[model samples]
Each structure stands twice: as structure tokens, then as C-alpha cells.
Target: MAGTGRAGVWAVGSAAVAVGLIVALAVRERTAAPTDARPLVVYAAASLRPAFTRIATEYEAETGQRVELRFGASEEMLTRVRLPSAVDPGDLFAPADESYVTSADKLGLVAESRPVARMRAVLLLAPGRMPPTAWGDLASRDMRVSLANEAAAIGRLTRQRLIATGLWRELEPRVRGAATVTDSANAAKLGAVDAAIVWDAVARQYPDQRTAELPELTGIEAEVRVAVLRQSARPADAERFLRFVLDPEHGLRHFRDLGFRVVE
Candidate 1:
């Protein structure tokens, strides 16, 4: 009877040991699963929507990795990355201007950065309106112009250019502030304004709007840059996506198709 009891006890202990081993293996596998298996979160400037959307789709198909994209004004995206109140911090950021990346780097929020593209500011005129011959034409009382507010990269660039040319004061009264270059372009498209200053690429999106290339505005260009966030939970995966974007055949092609000047 004693020997039978010992055997029973040993069998019960072995079963428990087997169950424990199985649970330990499961936990180890769950912890060791490749972080790349999870979706990479990217906060991108609204201006990058077209190109990024396409690139992300292709990347998912090719690598079997998923991507979650959040688009807004470049500054707004930066703010979201910095605060991240109710949301998870993004793994990557692609702002329309490099300045935002510089600011993020100053805050110790950036792990790496790369230049993606470049865009020049241009005047988008409403249909049937003759392109202005000079900057002063925008200041004319008959002209109603819309410009992006200072919160947007294009808006900041527009203000800087207009100030340098000594036309900001003259043009200020005639200008209606918009939240983004896209908004300013929309105002022109809807004929809410006679003209708007927007990125050349944005102007291309509207076939009805005519782009005016002025020698004075030639110097206004923004370098679109992407950065890996230091606080990213999946840094390695984020880096892989970054490299895919920087690849000429993959991401740059889409930007070029959208009329964005692809940077080498």
C-alpha cells in the first residue's frame, strides 16, 4: 500500500512539472517574438500622405509587416510625439521640414534622421486668373490671398520669404491665414481666395490651379526629413521601415510621381 502511494505521488509531481515546463516555454516564446511582427507606428506630415500611403502599403505586402500612419500638420505631429497622452508614442516621424527634426533632436527625442525630399514654395492661382508678374501684385487691394498660418512649415517659410522681400507688411492685410498649405490651396481651388502660396507639389495635385514660378520665390525650399523617435518601442523595426523609405526604388519613386523633388 505504501509503495503504491509513493508511485501515485511521483506521477502527480511529474504531471505538474510537465505543465510548468509548457507554461514556461509559452512565456519565453511570447517574450522572444520578433518586435517587427507588430505594426510600426509612424507620425507623418499631412503633406506626406500621398507618398507615404503608397510606400506603406507596398512595404506591408513585401515584408509582411504592418504600419499605422497618423497624418497631420508637421508641428502637430511633433507635439503628439512629445506628449503622447492617451496614445502610444510613434516609432517614426516624417515632417515636411527638417527644422522639426532638429527641434525633436534638441529635446533628445530623435534617434536617427534622413532627408527624403525637397519642395519649393510657389503661387497657386485660381482658375481664369492671370499669374501675378511680381510679389507686389499679391499686395494689390483687388487680390485676396490665403497663406498657411505660422503653425505649418510652409506658412513659416512663406512668412520668412515675404519678410525678406519686404512685402510681408504690405501683404499681411490681404492675406487670410490657413491651418495648412493644403488648406490655402483648397481656398484657391474653391475660389475663396484669388491665390495661395503652397508647395509646388501641392499645386500639382490641383489640375485647375496654375502654378506661378517667380524668380523671387526660387530660394524658398524645404527639405522633407524623416526621423526615428528615441522613445520608440520598436526601434529596429522602425529603422527597417526608414531604410525602405530612403530606398530610391521604393519610396522616392512615389514622391517623384507626386511631383515632390526626390533628394539623393
Candidate 2:
């Protein structure tokens, strides 16, 4: 009887030990699983590359997350994001301007949107060359003025707004002709055309490019929009990244240095 009782006691002890081992293993696995969030995909505007790159590097250092960038024109980026199978889409979309955001919002593709920075078109002229000091001067045959198309919303708006204000029309005959329109004003500047309309951000890039505010010019305050795409597998990470951009001091200064006017 005593031997049987001892055997029963051993059996119970063995079962308890087995159960404890099982719990221990589960706890180990739960604790050991990777919790570090890093490496997220980002699609941004080509024009925004300089300022955004600085913000990206800072983000990586503060957090372990890596930014895999896809940079291009805002229109191009918007089209890419619209594709049906863009499942597992980019973690973030930082378009050069907000028109893309309005379009993306209509498609229900953007998960989160925020206006982080603003900018407007400026008249760019070659360094050391005579620039039209006023809008009326553009009508002169000597002033070869260039401007970007409607696809660049601000570019298109700048023309109309300035004209509405009685500024652009003064130069419309000379500046609006086919010879004056270019895919991008930056291209015109690179081609060394006398003057072209371009974003303040872009204008700031070329040290040789001088910027002047054309009085009565249509000044559309384009906001640089940052959003999270719906296909993103990492929403939390995307939110974190968005916060990084909107952070008041550090990243904001980076944008300002690039000539982006941040909204209050």
C-alpha cells in the first residue's frame, strides 16, 4: 500500500513538472519574438527628395526603422498608388503638393493625410543675367519667360491667379506661347531660358537661379501632403513616421531650409 501511494505521488509530481515546462516554453517564445519595427517603404516627390531625405535619416537614427525610398514626380507617384494591385502599398506617400492627396482621398487609397509644409511658385531667372524687374517687362521680346503645365497644379494656378490679379496677362502674349511652356520650369532653367515659373523649393536648389515674387502673380499655397497608404501592413509604424514629419522643431526646420513654408 505504501509503495502504491508513493508511485501515485510521483505521478502527480511528474505531471506538474511537465505542465510547468510547457508554460516556461510559451513564455520564452512570447518574450523572444521580434518586437523591433524597422524598414518601411516610402514613396515621395522627386522635388521633395532633398528635404525629405534629411528627415528620413533623422527618423532612422531616432528609431531603428529603415526608409526604403521611391522618389518621382507627384503626378507619377499618384498614378502608381492608384493601381488596383498596389496591395502592400508604400508605407508612406509624401507628395510634392496636395493635389495628389485630394485625388488619392477620392479613391479611398490614403489611410491618413496631413499637411506638413507649404510652398508657392516663384519666377526664376538665371544668375548674372538681366531679369524682368516687373511683370510688365515680360511682354518685352527680350524676356523669354517659361512656365510648367496644368499637371503641375501650382504652376497652372500661378498663371491664372497672376492673370486674375492683372499680372500674368501682362506677359501672357510672350510667356504663354508654346515656346514658353515646358514640362517643368526647372528644365527651362537648366536649359538656361531667361526666366521660368517654378516652386520656391525648387528655385532654392540652384544657387545660380534667382527668385523674385511676381507682384499680382497667382500664389497658390501648395501644401506638401504626407499620407499612409491603405495597403500598408504596418499602420503603427506609418503613424510614427507621420508624427516624425509633423514634429515642430527638428524636421520642420529641415523643410524650411529647403524653402518649404510650413503652415502654422
Candidate 3:
């Protein structure tokens, strides 16, 4: 019994020392001879999460680079860029709406900002639920609908457009009385609510939940954008990433798969 106990202690100590050495070596490698290429940093809108992730992976595999993606509301991304070091200025900034893209661009945070993908507004239905074919259907007295707050997004823009055509004024009572506001359109994509007004990219991104197309005549359309952050350490790499995204063969197909419209 004593011999067995001594062997176990010795083996454990040996294993611990081996692990510590391996860790130290890895740290040394990271510090001493890190790659000259800057790590690809990206701050993006939540709606772009699905598509951007795919692009990021592809870019890394092709170039042997590392990518770090930050997902947040459009407003939060803007605020973080201006305020301080909470978020490292990544190689790229991708926003969910044109308004946000323009806002951040004007702040002088990026070398250039452009619409990478266009997303229409969409109506989301709960799991195993049927989507409304028209905006008026959302006004059904029994239907409990929701919309994300317009402060961080253009949902308010959508609402106003609807009202201008009188589509929303009739629905205003319905929206006010029942439509709950969330911080993001992605939240409305969840199945908990009966119906939600969300970005088209979100609707198409999560097909398992269920979505039916609203008529194209519906008064809402929005564009999603990308910008190269000025503070990024890898401007050339960032430009390469952007060029890869504009590549017709891969980038177009990738965006199309995520339900985005590639504008010429």
C-alpha cells in the first residue's frame, strides 16, 4: 500500500510539471515570434452574425490569420467605438442598418463604409406558426405582435413608413396596445412571441423557426453595411478581407445563403 501511494504522488507531480512547461512554451511562442500580420478584428451587428461568421472562417482558412468578432446592437457598436478600450477596434465594422453605418462613418472611425448586404424588413412567426401575409394581418385583435425599439435601429423608420401609407395608423392601436418592444430585431426572431417585426436577414437565417414572405409591396426595406475601422492594426489585411467579401464567386453566394441581397 505504501509503495502504490508513493508512485501515484510521483506520477501526479511529473504530469503537473509537464503541463506547466507546455503552457510556458506556448506563451513564449505567442510573445516572442507572433505573426507579423495583425489579428483580424471585427465589430458587427447581431443580424450579420450568421453570414459574417462563415466569411470570417473562410478568410482565416485561406490566409492563416486569426479573427475576433464582436456581436452587438448597432447602437452599442457605435457607442463602444467612440467611448474607449472596452472593445478593441477590429479590422472591420459591419452594421445592420445604413443609418448606423453612416453614423459610425461620419464619426471618422473608418476608412470607408459601404453597403455590403441589403436586408428587407420581415415579419416573424412563432415555431409551427403561420406568418401573416400582410402588414394588416398583424393588427388582428388576438395576435400579440412585437417590434424592436427604434432608438438603436430603424424599426421606427419602418413604423413611420407604414403609418405614412396608413398601414400602421390602423395598426397603431394594435401595436401600441399589444406589440412589445425589444432591444433588437434578433430578439423578435425567437419563437416565444406570436409574431415579431424583424430584419429580413434574421428571418431567413433561422428557417427552422418558420417565416413566410411578406408581399414585396410592404413599405419597409433596409440595407446592412461594412466599414474598415481606422484604428485597426491591419489595414492591408482588412482591405484583403473586404476584397474577398466582394469576390463574386464566394462572397455573393455566402450572402445569398444568409438571405441578403448583394447590390451591384
Going through the candidates in order, what is the number of backbone clashes in each?
0, 2, 1
> What does candidate 2's lDDT look like per residue over 207-248, in tens digits?
776678875554566778899988788889989888888887
Model 1, position 63, has a per-residue lDDT of 93
Could you tell me the lDDT of residue 110 within candidate 2?
91
Candidate order (TM-score)? 1, 2, 3
Off by over 4 Å in 1: 1-37, 85-87, 139-141
Which candidate number would show the highest TM-score if scored against the true structure? 1
Q: Tell me the tens digit of each residue's lDDT in model 3 across 1-264.
A: 366698888888999999999999999988955667547778887767777889888988888887778898677888877763634556788877778767867888778766677666666666766767665666663566566655645467767777677666565554422222233334444545576667666666566666656763265777777788787777888888878777767666689876778865
Worst 10 residues of 3 by lDDT: 176-185
**Which model is ahead, 1 or 3, in terms of TM-score?**
1
lDDT of 1 by residue, 27-107 (tens): 997775545555788999887898999999999999988898889888888888888544466899998788899899999
lDDT of 2: 0.74
Candidate 3 RMSD to the real structure:
6.2
Give each prediction's root-mean-square deviation over alpha carbons: 11.4, 15.3, 6.2
